[model samples]
Target: MTNHWLFWGFWVMANALASFMWGSIVLSATPAAFAGMLLGIVVFILVYGTLDAYLIKQNLSRWHDALRRSVYIKAGLQLMNVFLAFGWPASPELWAGIISVGITQDRLGIAQNHYPFGFALLNTLLTGAILSLMVAALTAIIFFIRKKHESR
Candidate 1:
């Protein structure tokens, strides 16, 4: 349950960040903007989902090393899901659906959107940091909780 929450939270944060990044880079509608947004979404899913899954798997393995091998395989499956589905950009709805699948497969929700961009490059940098931090915090919290529960 906790894992689910963490995963969704991370996905939501990543989604929002990707949108913000693309929005800042290409404000007006152009082929470049469309392509950039697609690329951004792909990168975001790969990086954030892979890292979070790895961390969770590591924590889970600590409880039962014998289960580690299977856990690793499951991680690969999850990674594939994110890469194949969540990475695609057919439409905003499709993207959102894929991201939701990634989150729910593990059990999780979208984090609060914090668009910190105000003006210039600073806006982009700040917004990116805020989004990254939001996802990181959720990931860390889930790992911590899992560790605590396992330790018991």
Candidate 2:
């Protein structure tokens, strides 16, 4: 249970860091604007990470057992994760947009600028999916190492 919490906590922290850095780099956000962005991102990460971690942890037990017995199943699962990665982006993007409204108004004192929803959506989805796939690839490498170690 503690480990589960820790896992999710780290995941949330990593996400928060990524969001903050990305926002800073792309938007050249002021400190206050970045704070607002970070606040929204942290909220999204907390909620999403907790739920995702719970599901993954539960499913991982079964996966681990099966993976230990069959390389084919392990490879297949990793392949599916490439698609599962697509589901991760929308919530954070939505939450960030919503939260940024208040933050921009209050802190930046900037008038809200309208962005086309479709363009933003497509951008977020593509970036998120690509990042997620990168993570999946790293995970596959770790699994490979573990498998190799176990066989020795």
The top-ranked prediction according to lDDT is: 2
lDDT of 1 by residue, 13-79 (tens): 4445444544544344455434544544445455555654665677754433322332233223233
Which stretches in model 2 have alpha-carbon errors above 4 Å?
A: 1-6, 15-19, 28-113, 116-125
lDDT of every model, 2 decimals: 0.42, 0.45
Candidate 2 lDDT tens digits, 49-133 = 5555554678865334333233233223334323436874443323443455445445645542333232223333333444444
Where model 1 places Cα greater than 4 Å from the true spot, the runs are 1-14, 17-26, 56-129, 145-152
TM-score of every prediction relative to native? 0.37, 0.41
Clashes of 2: 0
Clashing pairs in 1: 4-106, 4-107, 4-108, 5-107, 5-108
